[model samples]
Target chain A: MKWLPRILGAAMLAGAAGVGIATALEAPAGDPQVVELLSGLNYVPSQSNIDVVLGEGAVEDLIEIAEDSSIDSDPGLRIRAFRSLGQYDGNPQRATAASALRRAIADYGAESSGTKLLYLRASMLSLAAIDGGNAVSNLVTMLGHPSRDIRAACAQALGITGVAAAIQPLRARDLIEPEEQVRLAIADALFLLGSKG
Target chain B: MSVLAATAAMLSLYLASGLACGGAGAGAPCQSHSECDDSYQCLAQVCSPKCTRNSDCGDGFQCNEAGVCNRVFANLGDPCGSEWDCEIGQSCVLEHGDSNDDQKLESSCQEQGEGGRVGSTCIADDDCRDSLCSLGHCSQLCRITDDCPDGNRCESIPRVLGVDDSAFFAGCIEDTSVLSTTIAMSESSGTLRIPVPSSAESFAIVAEVSDKIHLVGVTRVDSPSDFLLFRESDSFEGFLANPIRYARSKEVSTLIFPSNGVQEIEPGVYDVEIEASLPPFGPGTAVPKVSVHYKLRDSHILDLTFYFLNLEDHPCKESMGIDNLDKSSAKNSDVFQDEYLGEIHNIFGYANIVFPEEPEYVNLKRERPDLDGITDEQDLRDLFRLADNEDGLAIFFVRSLPSDGVQTLGTTIPGPPRTPGGPSSGIVVALDSLCYRSWTTLARITAHSMAGQMGLWNNRDPHGITDPIGDSDSSTGNLMYFGEFGGTELSEGQRRVLSLYPGLR
Candidate 1:
């Protein structure tokens, strides 16, 4: 009975269906207020404290939902939280979300599951949504990661960034990247960036 | 009784009592209007003779337009002249902009399609195919965002994966512009009992409900009396994740028999019980329920060949024992025949090939990656070269993959007829050393590779970076879903796609 509400609450929080709640019992570890907010909804929440959380500088709390690996969080909630952070309009909180994304990419490794990889990739895209000033340089640095997925994520981030600065690095990465998917991502990034310029 | 006399008496009774009589007149029994004879058809579920056409009935009655003898206001989609003409599910609307008689604004009952076909234009979700009308056009299926039609972006096709995790590759759906007022409603329901054929190689069941609160499951136990065993620790989610334990498909509502290396069961009274929990319905609100059951009859069996390769210098090799070849071959083949594809294909009679020299062995792993640890394109072609004349699927068991679990779990050669990879489609699986064997892993890999080769796409996210079907965020118990080894069954869409395979011919 409690499971239904927990699932419904998490699903609404994430705006997705059956993302990653079925594998384990515990919700994603995060700030106590955020956790309480998520756990209290026994039924679908028609309204929430999202605006309050965002306005009261709960960007870090949202990031915790995105970053917490103790329990597998639904990608929708993390991505949504990240997007909200990107659009927060405040410089410091926005920067915090961007930095969290960077740390996630920097720490991404072989142990990452496909789902975790998706969360990280979405995180990078969140940075692009904000037009994060240093996203181009940060993504360019990520192009050298050993894992093809991270490099591809970086390429996608750069494409979404549509920054002129990413063009040269993307072209260079496109030339040397061995993985077909990563190479394609780099090509797409180059096209998007070039088109924007 | 004469028609006038009967009609007058029925009219008199109707006027006096304002109620219907079930056994009134010649008609002895009746339920709803639909069950009554032409003479008696109305909402009262009575035996009173009702008009066949509008003209026959008096002031209050008008013939129902669907050709039903009963007379009532227009139902959904019926032609209407006024506001009162339409029924509960219908609305009256104008057909033309002109006011003149030639092109006058004559209206008819208008209702949305609710589930139109792809490429068709629609004003609402109901007008679109699959109730997924978005951006004025019915949604298209896609692998990537680019595959979708213009002005439409891909959205997840829900409930096709499993309850625990999502399978992204159940195929991409377009985002609908129309917000559905009703959360979940399909076009069917009831206590449907499906008969299992004696010759069935395998069977799979899929249950998809609208809300997370609705619990849908399938079991083969004697009755729901054994439901407790299936509902472990009071956690429905946990129980759903492990359906195979309680004779249910894991996560998804699917089941395949002769499972876990067991022999086929004899034909008997196997009772398959389905469970669905209904939520509280609001008063006066009509809620539609959805339940679908499919039984694949006239089974078809496909041939399977297992080619075991060994390196002369390498310590890893297949061990032979008393009936080892037959037993292992049957076990491996069962994964295809009974576990996943059994309902559609009866995979049987596996042929094994052993290479004594290391050169051919080396060539297989190195040919494309070719023979070293994985099946390169060349490895697949070479293995199939010695397969049975009619054998369409070949699984090459190599001594070892260079990187073990990291590199050589299993791989499928993308083939012609769908994607242009090679002349044929097959799998190159790297199993554990002869002593430390795991059948589940091999079966899992084979299931993944075979599905790919058979033209089944991996249900990955739109970005297409995930590995295997499990990675796709599908919540259904589909074999193509990631996270689990064996699948409950191939989804209906998957079955339709795989039906076109040359091997199934």
Candidate 2:
């Protein structure tokens, strides 16, 4: 009976070592590829090509890069990661991406207003592409954001969603929107929605 | 008394007699109110009785605020019977019709206003008084060529306003003035508060940092900061710490004010702070030079010089057919030139394209490997430095670009004005895409990049955010639409913005 227990412990130790080796092999291969692709996603023309390289773990990788606020993390890279997440619009794992985007939007900490704005803009577009009708209410709520750029981005995202529910919220915001640029965005959104209908 | 004085006295007496006798009835022609009956008024050179509403005035007339019937003036270029029947500064003139027969002659309001009277330069409509600051000078509104000064013609120019599609006005413009000034920079990183004269309509500032010194950012001094009008950067916070409108490029940083409709840069002394940093490979200290191109007057022609870089040794040359391109001389063949020119003409009817020089073949790839695939921002900057056309936009056509979806068809967002051989000198277009096989696509891409360089933002950015221009929509047909292809039409607002580009001679 004592010899049987010793044999079981030895088997368990071997299993743990195998798992560790598998993780080490996977991390090195996967991380660098993801980082390379993420770095290329900053501008418009290269975005589509990089999306092809993104794999099953891409959503989680993007979430990690987007949420990384460590001293070593590049703010521009994080913003790009947030934007790249939108490329997974039809993926089953998009809900997870959307949730990560939502958390990024809600968690306003030590980041500058401009940085926060960049995050919010990237999140709104991704949410619109990923969630569509489900993202309408959240987008509608952001229409009242204090920043003119944010409000305008939200209005535009609402239009991009192509959801009928977005139209009412946009119209309501149109009445009270004081900023001229925001008003123009709302009008454009309304026009887009009307055309969609 | 002299004969002229006696005649004038008699005419006044006759006019007094006419008024004393309740002279002309309604609808009768009269030069003055004295010729009309008492309680009636002479309006539009016609004797008319007091009226309460437009109905009482009959067709082609409206009751005036003064309780008199007045002839309704026709719009600009509309047919009219008399000067009185047309708007102020407009006159009825008869011209032979297309048939060239006396009987076929038609009369229309030929003169709209005395145009080309004010030669003062202006940047915006608010800069002029009672006249429009169009094409860099105060121009008089006109309906026909007859209203303009000698050598000037009434042109229907696009108007920059948040209005409908038919937003155009006729103005008198003939010549343009392009001027440049050089400011010697004492240091690599310092603020130069250049005094922009009130006479300068639109100006472009080009800062040429030493080869070792990379331009960090160019900030136009302003309160509360409007930094990075074209593209945002992570380093924006540092620039925004001091209130300014910040712009950044590679070796050469160009700042074009009123770059788009969203920005309305008035004519005043602008403090431009040029910031540069020494890259790891660069020298410790460098002297930068700043060149300012001031468009004192407006011009219709957009001069362009196309640089076809020789990609004979490029890695992708054989695959992309770069080796087949004629490298002996500038590819000035009529086949591609005519197509390129035709596309530009079709998009901008008012804009004329002038090739300053035959397209030159530059063996730049032999010197720089980075030119092969412009994947890095520095590579694009290096490619732009190969341009040598200062009087016009320098468009560099390369063999290939990074196939990564993020690779730009054109590198510069809004290319620097009047600068040559610098990072922001001009736009770099990659000819690698299968899309470039169609000359129409290539032309559209060129036109789009030119419009962007000329200060027009995308109708809608990739983030789904629309431009500040109200008239520009998300229509795929709009030339300024964010997509790389399909869009060909330019909105009136966009045309108006493009007219402000300093490169237009």
B270-383, model 1: which lDDT tens digit per residue?
Answer: 334455544343111222232221112322233445555433222222322112222234344433223322321211111011111111111232232223233133343445
Error of 2 at B405 (Å): 5.5
Question: What is the CAPRI rating of model 1's predicted complex?
Answer: incorrect
lDDT of 2: 0.56
lDDT (C-alpha) at residue B309 in model 2: 55
TM-score of 2: 0.44
On residues B35-102, what C-alpha lDDT tens digit does candidate 2 reach at each position?
A: 87776676655565666654344434545677676656677668653333555455444332323332
Per-model DockQ: 0.01, 0.03
Two-chain complex of model 2, DockQ on C-alpha atoms against the true structure: 0.03
CA deviation > 4 Å runs, candidate 2: A1-197, B1-176, B187-191, B223-246, B262-265, B277-287, B311-323, B327-335, B350-375, B404-411, B435-437
